[model samples]
Structures are given as C-alpha cells and as structure tokens.
Target: MNLEISIIVPDRIFLRDNAHTIILPTLTGQMGVLTNHIPLLTGLDTGLILVRKSVSSDWIGVVVTGGFALVNDNKITILVNEAELGSEINAEEAEMAFLAAKSALENASDEKRKIEINSQFKKARARLVCFNSIV
Candidate 1:
C-alpha cells in the first residue's frame, strides 16, 4: 500500500508524493507512519522528515523548523514554518550559520534570547546534518 505525503512551507510546497513510509520528528519524539496507520495529529520538532517512496527506494530527507503534522487514512500533511530539501542546503553555508548561532547562543544573557539562539542553532544543525547525509 502506498501513502500520500505532502509537505508545505509558508512560501512553497516542498514535496507531494506517494511513499511507502515516513519518519517524522515530533516535539515529543520520532514517529513512523505507513499506509493503513492510525490517524494522528502532532506538533513537529526542528529536524528532518524522512520519506521512503518504496521498499527499495532511497529515503528523501527534508529539514524542517517548527511544524504540524496531520495523518488521516493514508494521507499525511506537514505544514512547517520552514522547509528545505537535503540537496538544497549548502554545507559550507550551513556550517557558517551553525557557528554564528553557536556564538550568539554563548553571548545570549537573557532566557528568552538564549531560547531564540538555541532555535537558530537547531535549525543550522539540522541543515548541516541534511547536507552531510546527501554527500
């Protein structure tokens, strides 16, 4: 059985296709979805969304930041604030961004500022991870 998955960002749709399985990084933890899986709705974490179109197909990695996921029947929809395919990320830029975020995090004094910096750090890290996995 094939499951349909769609990933939407603010400006564009990252992916829309049929897949054999999907692994989502939720706020609570990772969740795996497949055809015939029970319905679900959950908040996403800042990380990767892995999709497999077939048993023999390679996984497609998408880096996302803050999203919501809904699953009903065999269809899955992900609405994220930001989304980028693995191939779209530049490793060098991601590394530089990661370093910047790290420095900002270290310099943040207030709790709120620290939280914001941490979020940026997470996003940069996710981008680097996706880029590395593609290589």
Candidate 2:
C-alpha cells in the first residue's frame, strides 16, 4: 500500500493523498519523496507540488508555500502557511496582488518593508504560476 498524506494551510485543505510519490516544493528545491523514504522535515518553497498516485503515471499538481513538512509512518503531513490550486485561483486577483506587492517593494524604505513586500510578491507570482500551469 502507498502512504497516506494530507496537506493543509490555515484557510484550505490543499491535498489528501494515497500516493506513490509526493513531490514537495521544498525551500532547498523541488524534492520527490516516496514510500519507505527516509524520515525528514524541511521548509517548503512557493512552488508546485506534484503528487503521483500509486497506480498512475500522471502527476497532480498543487501550489504550496512557506511551511514545513514531515514524513513518517508511511505518511507525509504538510502544514503550510499557504496553498492554492489552479482551478481555484483567480487571474485578475493574482495580478492585482502582484501589482500591489510590486508597488510596495518599489516604495519600501526599510528592511522590514522590503521583506514583507517580497514575500507578498512571491506568493502572488506562485499563484500566477499555478493558475497558468497546463497540467
């Protein structure tokens, strides 16, 4: 049997899985973890998570950002800061958010402001990517 997994952010359930592989958008980079994989914990990046179901070759994608994931007991639990899906994302809203973040980044005068704006900018861009993906 494949592992069971779930991914959630504060506002939504990103995914629930019985999968052969769970490709996480880790801060270090995209990493594919499979059943009986080593126990690990890592920070997630703002990028696509591609889940491969046990009997299928095709991968399903989700967007995850700013979180840590744990793998153990044939399960992977991801507690994300945020997550979004292609079908649920609104392009207009994402663009508007991107523009606002850009403006803030441009006008930011302090380190904290820069950091805040940058985080928003990345989140917006990741949403755009998820919404625009073909698969």
Candidate 3:
C-alpha cells in the first residue's frame, strides 16, 4: 500500500502523489514514515525531504524551508513556507550559492548578521543536498 502525500506552500500545491515511504527533516531529526505509521504532527526544518514511490523506484528529493507535517490515516499533508523540487534546481548554481553563503556566514561580523547569514547558509545547504540526492 502507498501513502497519499501532498506538499503545499503558500502560493500553490507543490506536489500530490503516492509514496511507499518518506523521510522528513524534522526539528528533532530525520523521521521516516511508511504506510500505517502512527499519527503525529511535527515541526519541519529547512532541509531535504526524500520520497520513494515504491521499493524499486528512485527517491524524489524536495527542498523545504520549514513548516509542519501532519500524518494521519495513511496520509501526509505538508504545509511549508517554501518548497522546490530537486529536479528544478541547477546543481552548479546551487553549489555556487552554497559556497557563497558558507563564506558569508564565516565572515559575519555581528550577531544579527550571523543569524541571517546562517539561515541562508542552511537553506543553501539544503538545496545542495536535494540536488545531490537526485544526481
């Protein structure tokens, strides 16, 4: 059996599909969900979400900025602030962005700047992760 999964952002529904399993980047850590998994709700982190359609299928990667995931009755609804499919990201561009963000974070002079740059660095890292997962 497959689990029904829907990913939504403020502007539109990013994805709706059935998957054999899903690995979510939660605040606590990575959480794996399968069919008939226990019902729960959790806060998401800015990272990659891996979805496998079936045992023989390749995993699909998605970058999510942060949000909430709700699992109930073999269905998952993810509402995120921002989301992008890995396939849509340019690997070279993502790599460059990641490097730039990393450098900026390292050179940050103030606490506020550090915090802002840190978030960008994390998001860039997540994008890189998603891109690499698919490649």
Which digits, one per residue and each the tens of the lDDT, describe model 1 over residues 1-135?
799999999988878999999999999988999899999899999998888999998888899999899999899999999888988888889999989998999999999999988989989988888888768
Question: Would you list the rank order by TM-score, best first?
Answer: 3, 1, 2
Question: Which pairs of residues clash in candidate 2, taking residues 3 or more apart in a chain or in different chains?
Answer: none
Question: What is candidate 3's lDDT per residue for 46-119, written digit by digit as tens?
Answer: 98999999999999999999899999999999999999999999989999999999999999999999998887
C-alpha lDDT values of all predictions: 0.91, 0.79, 0.95
Error of 1 at 62 (Å): 0.7
TM-score of each prediction: 0.93, 0.78, 0.97
- Candidate 1 global lDDT: 0.91
RMSD of 1: 1.3
Backbone-clash count (model 2)? 0
Give the Cα RMSD of candidate 2: 2.6
- Reference-based lDDT, residue 8, model 1: 93
